[model samples]
Target chain A: MDPLILASEECDIAREVVCVPANVLDLFEFNSVPIFIGLGAVIIALVMYFALRKPKLVPGKFQASVESLISLVSDSIARDVIGPEGVKYVPYLLSLFFFIWVGNLMELVPGINFPFTSRMAIPLTLALLTWVIFVVEGIRKQGLHFFLDLIWPPGVPVALKPLVGLIEFVSTLIVRPFSLTVRLFANLVAGHVMLALLLGSAGFFLLGVLGGDISVLRGSIGAAWFVVGVAIFMFEVLVGFLQAYIFTLLSAVYIESSLHPQH
Target chain B: MIADVLILAEEATESSGIDLLIPTVPELVGGVLAFAVVFFVMWKFAWPQMQQLLDNRQKAIAGQIQEAEAIKAEAQSLLDDYRQQVAGAKSEANQIVEAARSQADTVKADLIAKAQTEAQGIVGKAREDASSEKARAMTEARQEVANLSIDLAEKVVGNSLDRAAQKSLVDNYLASLEGA
Candidate 1:
């Protein structure tokens, strides 16, 4: 069978097991991790709903834990990116943060390992939402001037003005989504591939032609893979949270830039 | 390749479902649909609530921190007040003690001076009395001596006068009486 067929077969297996969103949804072959992602969000919402049935002066352990995480995201992304305005947007950013983080983390769970973010659809959709928020708010606040400000942020030299406008426009509109999709997709794929490769090295080598042994190569592979796997696991964990954060951060910055039209 | 995947998704159904043979990754249509679902669901259900919760939460935490600061300031003020009061009390106590000491010293000195003056007056009056008594005694002694001398003379004359001298003394006495 062709490798594409094999890959398709693997995807089919992934579909059966993973929450692979049907291609009917998009041009990208992303698993409908959002189904799970959204469901997870709803579930988180439900959890928070029940947890916060009555908002208390002294939060319970679970409430405190959830609130702490929300606060952390608020501090890290909302404050850092949006500044004072960021304070208000923390809720949106926090939801984005936790949802993405949980989506990425789900992959670590046994038998449920493929993160939806590996699919371009997940992050792309999220980034697109950010774009919409910024755009809507931008137009609402600055009228048609929001886009103009993107082109020339008022203080630029008249000579360098057109070039800077073009650059800023392309960066904000075109590069924004591309980079968002790429950042999340690439990290997730890389992390998954790394894990798979680490896990399969022994099986692959041992099953090779005329190979009836798990040799020193296999041992080294296992040991090295284990160590690297552990380190990568931690890094990927950070990346999972960080990419979501970056997505939100960039979104906030982009919105601020568009809204303020200043440096 | 992406186009082919789009066709398959379009063809997808509960009965026909996802075909396992196709391998193409859906990029654009999937992007649109996923974007739609995510944005819609989030905006309608999750985002607003989350945003409200977060906003309220942010305000609350900030309020908490601000309240904590206020409590700290109030506590600090109370502490400062108590400290001032203690300091004032100490100074006041010291002032009272100092005033008492100075007042006692003045009183003691006045009493000592008054006592000295009165003692001197008593001594001077006692000396004067002693001198007057001495003068009186001397004068009295002188007069008693004179009287005794006179009395002795009289006795001696009377002794000499006897009977003979009685007529002469009588004459003389008679002369003295006549002359008197």
Candidate 2:
């Protein structure tokens, strides 16, 4: 038996699943990503189904509430960023935001504590979809010369064109989607890791199984940490909702910028 | 710390592992089947009815708005007609009052002029009758005066006057009478 493995085993097993390697951050893995994506898809279908199964003059309470929420998300995030012209994309953005949010929330279930969004693959895939939409939509709307708008930016001087063009194209092509994916993935990973550490450390502190001298002050601090962890977990629920919103909001803003440019 | 917990959970899962993974290839197949079924059901049941309901609701709203506008127009026209009728009635009453006043004035003047003419005609007839009566009285007096003087002269001349003188006077007298 390896001492390193033994030392590693001292930590909670759930923490290993939630944490990722430093080296593999750049690589894309598909294993758990599609599974969570599929889960999100199922949740979307059920929500749509349950909300729309029956027909009524006035909507049922649940359906009406869901409809209002959907429309609110549409009006707030989609309409505010993309304007009324982008109302057609409401269904896609609404489903995407909710699906990602539910994926984050699924890890909070008692027996089902694996944070799927903590994996890089899910956010990366969604970011890819968003980037594809923006690029395709920009070109489709403004023709192939839309790329020129990114480079020239319409109002800048000819002397600075080359430097600005290089910077703009690189940032537009790379940094935009990269930031979106990494922001969501990093937030999920950090939030999950923080929650696991706090919760798992409290267990060790209360039980005193770390083989060091246990004291009344350490145990009390552990209780305090445990309570604080609970409070943070509650706050993290809010963060889950916010991060999903930010991602969707950023994507919408990006699409808006891409489609029209600054010209 | 959670890693150790996860190991325990993993060991437990492995002892009675049921393969929770939903698989990859089957997803493409199941996704198609599921989406197709959902689309078909939506097309068959939900869409047609929802569209019909939306159309009917739009029509109902439009009809209500049109009917309201029409009623408003009708009410406005009715108000205008009533106002015009009231104006006409007022005008007609004024004309009738004016015509009656003029007829009363004309009739009053005609009555006044006719009364004056009647009074004048009566006065003229009375004046004519009085003048004719005065002429008749004057003629009767003159005939009586002439008869009385002649009687007196015959009485005086009958005894006083003898043959030739008396006869001369009487002859003068009788000659005068024949001449007159």
Best by lDDT: 2
Model 1 misplaced stretches (Cα beyond 4 Å): A1-35, A83-88, A202-220, B1-180
Please provide, for model 2 over B59-100, each residue's C-alpha lDDT reduced to its tens digit, 9 standing for 90 to 100.
Answer: 878999999999999999999999999999999999999999
lDDT of 1 by residue, B81-163 (tens): 99999999999999999999999999999999999999999999999999999989976765565455555766977743344
* Predicted candidate 2 versus true structure: per-residue lDDT over A138-197, tens digit per residue: 898888788899777888899999999999888988888889988887787667656655
Which portions of model 2 show Cα errors greater than 4 Å? A1-36, A55-57, A207-217, B1-180
Best by TM-score: 2
Which CAPRI category fits model 2? incorrect
List the candidates' TM-scores in order: 0.54, 0.55
- The TM-score of chain B in candidate 2 is 0.57
lDDT string, candidate 1, A214-256, tens digits: 4554344445546656777778778887777777777777767
Highest-DockQ candidate: 1
Q: Give the CAPRI rating of model 1.
A: incorrect
The superposed Cα distance between candidate 2 and the true structure at residue B177, in angstroms, equals: 76
Give the TM-score between model 1's chain B and the true chain B. Answer: 0.61
